[model samples]
Target: MIIQRLDELAEVIEVPLATLNQHYLDTNFKLKVPVHFARQIEKGNLNDPLLRQILPSIDEAKSVKGFSQDPVGDLNANPIDSLLHKYQGRALLITSPQCDIHCRYCFRRHFPYEQAKKRHWQTALEHLASDNSIHEIILSGGDPLTLSETGLLELLRQLEQIPHIETLRIHSRTPVVAPERALKLDWLAALKASRFNVVLVVHCNHPNELSDETKTLFEQYRRADVTLLNQSVLLKGINDSAPILKALSKKLFSQGILPYYCHLLDRVEGASHFEVDDTPAWQIFETLRKELPGYLVPKLVREIAGEPYKTPIIKTL
Candidate 1:
């Protein structure tokens, strides 16, 4: 998927293919992008915010100081093969590592999918059944929505049996990149019909990522009894501006999705290019708050090495 884009981007932008040599451009993890997302990139523009995300570049292969394989300590927190209990009330399940689009800055890009493989889909379910303390299960990775309706529905049904799991939080970029997946599944309708509190935590970094198509997608999901929230990573050249963040929040609210977290990019080994400094990130959020209602301002936070929860970048005035 990425190989084709590398070539396409090189051709369109007239940047010599040699500039993005295969040795350096091809990160260990392969790029995965759907055609819908590819259309969003501005042809001949290499600096397109959307393009910078999925397009592999020589920079990704460079190692920088402080970046590591397991940035968030995912390996240390795992109690089972596919489950991670980092926070007190929630448990995240790596349902599948198959994502429709591969963002270059993904923190989990270097995640050892093979080591954490689940023998049976029921493996995580059985573990959840035993832990009554866990009240929520976050379905992540590649993207849970990528699963077949039958597979997804079946997983949700099993989760239903785990009485303690009161909330189902799905973290995916599908709503932005592949709104059709959400439209196809009737996600909000199907999940809301179940017993759990369905929360779709979508990933949208720029306001531009939200379009008329995605807006309608959110409306359809909102029509159902599901909660919609958005989380964005503060990227260097993409959304480092206060105006961008404010616009993103407003756009999200218009679509019935609240601005949730504006994360300082994780210090993943290959994604150092996206990092925004803590001071600037804090200032950006502060400026953003003055222009918008408090509710619309997303909390600016970072995931430090061993923190149980996200560390807020600044103390709000």
Candidate 2:
């Protein structure tokens, strides 16, 4: 689908071409919009929250003072080329550089993905085996679920053999963006069959993303041995409102998915527009706290450039 540009999307839905911003569409970053995820957009409605996250806007073309290319310091933490070992006891692996949908605000939009792709995983696995301190492995990237089934299984099987590695965390947008992938993934049970506890972290910004099919997918996970969790980026003009966040939490709870981190947008170059200032961001979280139980309220935090863990924002004031 060439629906990457607002004008292109306008053509598809018969919306006004003049309304689209062409300057930002020229951004060098890759643009991908999967058919399943694109269907969630309201016709002719450019301000649709889902669309806002994926659409390129003029704001993205500006340079915000604090924003930089490697905002989260992925390069600094790259011990082995494909692996990121920022925090102790856990590590993140770039399983692949492919994703089903290209979220405009992705912090890694400007990351040196080519460098990450060139290095194979065997060396990273060896580094893991050498360190008894690290126990959990996080599969991340454009989305690890994008990896071939045979490759994913091989990786999981290898991780399980490492004596100290007790957990395998797979973070992917696949299940939420296209729930059928979750249904068709036959390797989950087998992966769980290994000693490591398997967890799937899904990215969802709105309740609308959790369609009937998505909810059913969650139901399947609940019945299985795998644990399901959701992490939503606190995007401005998206789920910034308290009511929207609360509704998302309630919906997630009802579907057997736990609300995990509600991370403030990383100060990355192009995604500065999505960064909600501290005051309003916390105010929304505070209001959200009043409306939902503690468990349902995800920890609101910021990923400081070189921090070992996500620094939680304990108070709004």
Candidate 3:
């Protein structure tokens, strides 16, 4: 459930709204919630002084230079309204344009969601069915889990019909933003019942986000027989340090989740504040290499437009 008002969420969770508001304010209005789980609570007003810290204001977005509406060549790859085929064996389908919470650093913040919504399962299925080499269908967007259970089930059913589509990967922040959404046993059952192999890619930036509730959600996915992976962004104030990254990876691994990708900030509008330079990113990665096992070291990657795969940041020592 998208709680637009903090009070409403407090009511549901039986916490005081003032307490939640104060938490945001006490943190200098910075995003205190983990990136993975921060999207569920809706801001009543973006201009609310306390809210503006985390929620991007229109003026702030406009002030940023060189931020394009289509940052990562989505326009070029979008063959259908909802489908984007850029990689060899994978096709990306934007299932929903609405997120439970909007992150200030979201790369697709300026994407024309209204236009994309017109392209639904029918349009996406046509694109997926037409390509024989497409072995994986990636569900991404405002967060695909925001879709109703029925909507997701319908999508899964359509995709299952494509024999060539062997894997279905859902990239979502729902488990982080709203643990309640992840607790939906029915949705997990539907995903497991589907014929396609399922993988859930979750986003987590800080260790604080991995509360007991979130860990339980990961276990729920594991029980449902879904492969779990985590992708984190290299953010300036949030998680640029080596210790933070190492701790986050350890916590995720303890929960049976693998650290997948550590992405460089996609130079999107309003998100320039979070960009960590390549040199610093590499230095941090080197530290992580020494501290954590090879498997726990997430590949440092940058998504260049029109590239078949993410470019790994190689360091020459």
TM-scores of the models, in the given order? 0.92, 0.94, 0.84
How do the residues 1-317 of candidate 3 rate in per-residue lDDT, one tens digit apiece?
44445555445444466655654322111233333343322334332322332433333434577666577898889887788889999999988887766666778877877777834669779878888999999999878988888788778888888999999999998786677775767778987787878999998787766777888888889988999999988888778899999999999999889999999989886667678889999999999999899999999999999888999998854
* lDDT, candidate 1, 1-317, per-residue tens: 22345566566545566664543365567656666666666765667788778777678877899998888899888888788889988999988777888888888888877765546457778888998999999998778887777778778888899989899999989889878776755445577688888889999998878888888888777777779999999999998998888888998999899999988888988889888887777788778878898999988888986787899886544
**Clash total of candidate 2:** 0
Clashes of each: 0, 0, 3
TM-score of candidate 1 to 2 decimals: 0.92
* Residue pair clashes in candidate 1: none
Evaluate model 2: give its lDDT. 0.82
What TM-score, to 2 decimals, does candidate 3 have? 0.84
Q: How many angstroms is residue 16 displaced in model 3 relative to the true structure, after the best TM-score fit? A: 14
Per-residue lDDT over 1-317 for candidate 2, one digit per residue giving the tens place of the 0 to 100 score:
32455555666645577765543466777556665567777777878888787767778888889999988888899898899999999999998987777888999988777877825688989989999999899999978877777878888788888999998898988888877765645576676466878888999989878888888887776665778898999998899999999999988888888999999998898898888988998899889888888999999999997887999986657
Q: What lDDT is reached at residue 160 by model 2?
A: 80
CA error at residue 160 for candidate 2, angstroms: 1.3
Between candidates 2 and 3, the TM-score winner: 2
- Residue 204 of candidate 2: its Cα lDDT? 91
Give the higher-lDDT candidate: 1 or 2: 2
Clashing pairs in 2: none
Q: What's the TM for model 2?
A: 0.94
